[model samples]
Target: MFSYRHAFHAGNHADVLKHTILVHVLDYFNRKDAPYWVIDTHAGAGIYDLRSEWATKRGEFADGLDRLLAAQAMPDAIERYLQAVQHFNPDGVANFYPGSPWLALQAMRGRDRLRLFEMHPTEIEVLRDNLKREAAGTQRQVAVYQADGFNGLKSQLPPAPRRGIVLIDPSYEDKRDYRHTVQALSEGLKRFATGCFIVWYPLVQRREVADLQRALTRLATPWLHATLSVSKPAATGLGLHGSGMFVVNPPWTLHDALATTLPWLKATLAQDDRANFTLARHGD
Candidate 1:
């Protein structure tokens, strides 16, 4: 039983980092005239209401997107993400937030295709309604499923699309999720070696996170790993204070974009003194 509801954490520090990179990737794909497909493994509700009870309980976004939104002279990459967020909350009230599906839909050209998978029944219903409401009168194709994202990878890979992007953003609600990420990503690379793959993971303790990185590096895949830590070590050492994104077959321009955006993220989102960034290529 999957009980991870993204509503509570939508637009948090991790979401900021993941969605920023995602937007840049989509932008790169849009530069080409050829059509491309995007597979969103673990796609949550297409949109989120920041004013809802879930969002207001802890108000996680208050420390994430809120900081980004308040910054001046933002980098272009961040500007694109913030602009998309603004589009969803036209009143400038920021009452709503767009998840991966909605963000991909905003960036997709008419020829592009999107495949979204969500396992939660209630979230899936919200996802469908959100997509229908936002994509009305448009021919841009979309396919959504209430199934396991890991299975969707095997079933939908190499999606009639020679070129594509597949995003794996699991809730990590279970400790088993970490191992599942490794296994699923291994299979995905075997099936779609050339497709761009983005995997997001949180950083709680340095040792555990390092082990995860070493495991991914052992895959011997050509990939780039970028990390942004938002706080100092916790006294209890039990909460997420930082996060990272692993990109397989990243676009040539992504490294440069990260160089510019990550420093700013650290400055804006850090909750304590331990904030930093790392950009490295794996299996090069």
Candidate 2:
């Protein structure tokens, strides 16, 4: 839906889980120095200002990044994420936040490249400008596309370097996106079976969420699934309670690192008594 502008929800709890895990996966790829590509489907504006009118209207960051800023003794993984956030907000003020593409760039080596696809036309414009100015020029480090990521991302498979990460995070404003999400991965795996794929999903009172998870399991690839629930679902049975990341071909060290840090996140980001986390995995 065109109405789903990410500007309003920029640094919410969902972004926290998504980007934190994103850094972990990207860092693992960086270790080999082989030069891989980071593909971001549904890439939003490259950066967001938490103090903007849209962000102020939602006030989501107060319950998201703000909670973690003052945290002491965070696990190493989470600490690294905050350090990256600090890179953008150098004044010791938590006003700016990085979207996935920006986070990938931060953790990438000189040879690493990024392919970003966004369907929202306006967001695509901002995304293009951001890459041109902040992320370097086109045909250089970044490529931005104004198209449905589900369909557009396929052309980027088995990237030039033969190593890559595909990040799929649709607005889910359309339920069809759930089916398309799995379809994109299925098609992508046929071309690059070993490529890392990360799917970010919201925790809501909806059946599609579970169905999507089931479809992912049927892919039968080695994977890790982690979710953070910050509070009980609302009595009205609406809105997001948390978010999760399903990593296919995840880093071997990721599960252990999350095992150490998720509990900390659940507790630190919790909004009420029902806060918690769930972690499951197979084929390390």
Candidate 3:
């Protein structure tokens, strides 16, 4: 069952990194005249209310986007991400947060198409409603499905749009999720080798993260991995200390973009000594 709900962690440090890179990728895709497709596996409610009980319960944004917003002389990548979020919050008072699907919609053009899959019924309803409320009148095309994202991805592969991005942002609530990500990504690459893939993972214990990286590296496809750790090593066993993103067939500009933005993020959001950032490419 799909028990993962993004409401509790919207706008956290991980979202900051994932969405920043997502915006850049979408922007790059838009640069071309040919139409492109965006498929969001594990799509959550398109928008989130920071003041809502779920969000306010942890107030995660306070440690993430909030800090990034307060930082001075922001990098261009971060500036673009903030601009997108600002689009949702016209008054500039951070009240709402846009998940990947909504963020992708904001950057989509008339020729672009969006395919979103959310297994959670309530989240699926909210996702549809939010899209209707926020995307009305836009010429961009969208298709949402209330089904398993893993299965949804396989069904939609090699979309009418031969060119596009496939985003995999599973909740990772289940240990099996890690294995599922690798399996799904391996299959996706086989079907759409040219499509860009972005996989987001939380950085908790060293062993888990290392195993994930090892599995990703084993994929018989070229990929790039980037990570931004914002907290010190937890005291033995604790909560999420940081997060990372693995990009398969990443845009050439993404490397430079993250290089410029990650340091700023580390300095602005790091809560302890283990905070740092790393950029690497595996498989040419």
Candidate 4:
């Protein structure tokens, strides 16, 4: 479990898709005057250095965010998401990438709160240091814990504000993560039925991956599901070809926002003719 590190995949196509939707959701929450809580399960290092050894080892961003930065005619939501990314690269250089934790903090107001959980030993420490350096005076509003988010999420549900956004994204290195994710979401809803839930999963050639997607869609809640395929699945089936985000209790505007953004993402991030996207929602 500790073996999975997001630095290797930060700013990749999946991150682009995941974080783009995240920015829109956070923005939607901000529209209301009531303060809300942002709960990040499986929070990785809060921020990643694109120039660091880990990020450069894969250079995943070269085809992911880098492509978007150089592209033209971005849709409204995509443009907003890039602006959030730019907040970290203040020098106008894409040297740094903020993970979900940092992005949540960046978009949150002082009245809002952030709760983060990371299971990786080293990652927890790095998350703490990054939060302290980049988000001074946020200690009172942010809480970090070195524990399994899947199990720890229940205790934080129905947060004090009674309005919250829960992000459940695990590395899925352990095959059981699929089951755990379903179980966690089911239990979480029991505690906070109206809370927004966002789940991110990789599009690999595994049966469990497909199974997980199907399971989430069958939850019988209002949801918006969007997928982006950037390349053909490798013959060896060893890497991610794309990713998807399933949002429960999604904002009414989410589907339309993604409908416009997914196609642009497909064209910008595609590595071959096989690239494509999917958008489906079950709500008014």
Candidate 5:
């Protein structure tokens, strides 16, 4: 259960899709004066070194974030997302990657709070150390826990301000993660009906992948779903071909932003002619 490590795939295509929408949601939340909490259910190590042994072993970012940074005339949303990533690489070089926890810190204001949970013991320690070094002042605004995010989430719902964004992005290494994702979201809604929820799932050939998509869409909530398929599944079906993001109670402007961004992104990340994208809302 603790085998999966995000450092291996930190800035890959999935991260592109997940973090871009995350940045948009954070930006939307900031538009209002009411303070809101950002709860990351599966927070990783907070930051990753692209040159590290784990990251260099895979070099997945070469086809993901590196492509975007090398491209020109990015869509508005994608551009903003890149800018956020650039915030971590202040020397104007993309040598490091910031995970959801770090990205949330970039957008959160003084009144806003961030709650993170990670089940992996090693990752929890790294997360805390990263915060200590890079976010010294965030001690009061951020909380990190080494516990199961899926089960621990209940205690943090319906935050003191009654406004929050719950991000459920388990690694799904365990087959049960798919089921747990659906269950967590269902329970989360009951506690914070109006809170924004962002879920990220891989586009694999597994039945659970399809089942998770179906379950999320059928929920009784206004939502938006977006996917980016960079290639057709391999013959052995051993690797991720793409990924999707489902946003419940999404911002009014989110659908349009993604509609304009996905097309260009599909072309940018295409591994073959099978590369494509999807953007749909509840009524669609």
Candidate 6:
């Protein structure tokens, strides 16, 4: 489906979880001297205006970044993610929200490379324009492609530096996207078994999501799976209840940091008794 525009939901709860994990992953990569690549398979427009008509109509950020921005005394991991967001808003306002590509670029070093894929025509153009403006015409640091990330990511595996992170999170507007995500990861692991992998998924009422989780667990690797549910399933099964991030080959420090951070997120963002959190790990 070409209808999925991330701008409408930018900075929503899913983004809070996805970007938290993404920042942690990128931070870990920066700790090493060897350069690492960040491959974002579903890079949306690098930036989103919260005041825009599209975002104003839904107001998803009101419950997501807005809540986080109001809180204080966050755990270091959570604080770090928000600090990265702060870079875009030096004027001390929340009129804009950084998408995944923007957050990734902010955290990545000049030596590190970025390969972004966005199949949507409008998003690709916006993605390029945003990078150009943000990079101040020095966008060679990142490469943006208007292509299917699933197939396009194949050649990037086992990157020259032999260290990197592959972030795969499609809109899942098409059922086949679920299968495609798993297949891409499986193939990627074969080529770069030690590289970090992060997958973001919505907590929707769907069997394909369940199947995707079950299939991911079948991969024999050290992993961490964390989720935050801000509300019970919608009565009509129509909205995103929450979201999750499944990480493979995660940093040792990451699992522990999130263990402390998830509870605070659940409490601060809860909608009802249905709000809850989970942090599970294997082969640690």
- How well is each residue in 1-284 modelled by candidate 2, as lDDT tens digits? 79888889988899989989998888889889799999999998989988899999989999998888878779999999898888988898988899998898888877889898988878899888777777664457777788888998889988988999999999898999889999998999898999999999888888999999899877778999999999999999899999889999999999999999899999899999999998999786
Per residue, candidate 3 scores C-alpha lDDT tens digits across 93-150 of 9899999888988898888888998888899999888888887965349988888788
- Return the clash pairs for model 3, or none: none
**Model 3 Cα shift for residue 64 (angstroms):** 0.2
Candidate whose lDDT is highest: 5
What TM-score does prediction 3 earn? 0.95
Query: 1-284, model 5: which lDDT tens digit per residue?
Result: 78999999999999999999999999999999999999999999999999999999999999999999999789999999999999999999999999999999999999999999998999999999999999999999999888899999999988999989999999988989999999999999999999999999999889999999999989978999999999999999779999999999999989999989999989999999999999889942
Give the total clashing residue pairs for model 2. 0
Full-model lDDT for every candidate: 0.87, 0.89, 0.87, 0.92, 0.94, 0.89
The true-structure Cα RMSD of candidate 1 reads 1.7
Distance from true position, residue 70, model 5, in Å? 0.6
Q: Candidate 3 local accuracy as lDDT? A: 0.87
Comparing 1 and 4 on lDDT, the stronger one: 4
Q: Is candidate 1 or candidate 3 better by lDDT?
A: 3
Which has the better TM-score: candidate 1, or candidate 2? Answer: 2
Candidate 5, lDDT over the whole model: 0.94
Q: Predictions ranked by lDDT, top down?
A: 5, 4, 2, 6, 3, 1
**TM-score (all chains, Cα) for each model:** 0.95, 0.97, 0.95, 0.98, 0.99, 0.98
- lDDT score, candidate 1, position 4: 77
Residue-by-residue lDDT tens digits, candidate 6, 75-126: 8988998988888889989788888778778877777888999999988998
Which runs in model 3 stand beyond 4 Å of their true positions? 138-140
Over the stretch 1-284, how does candidate 1's per-residue lDDT look in tens digits?
Answer: 66778899988999999999999999998889999989998999888999999998989999999988888878899999999899888888888989888888888887889999898989899888877887784434898888999887889877786889999878776666777888888898888899999999998764656777888877677888999888876889777888899999988889889999999898889887888888888554
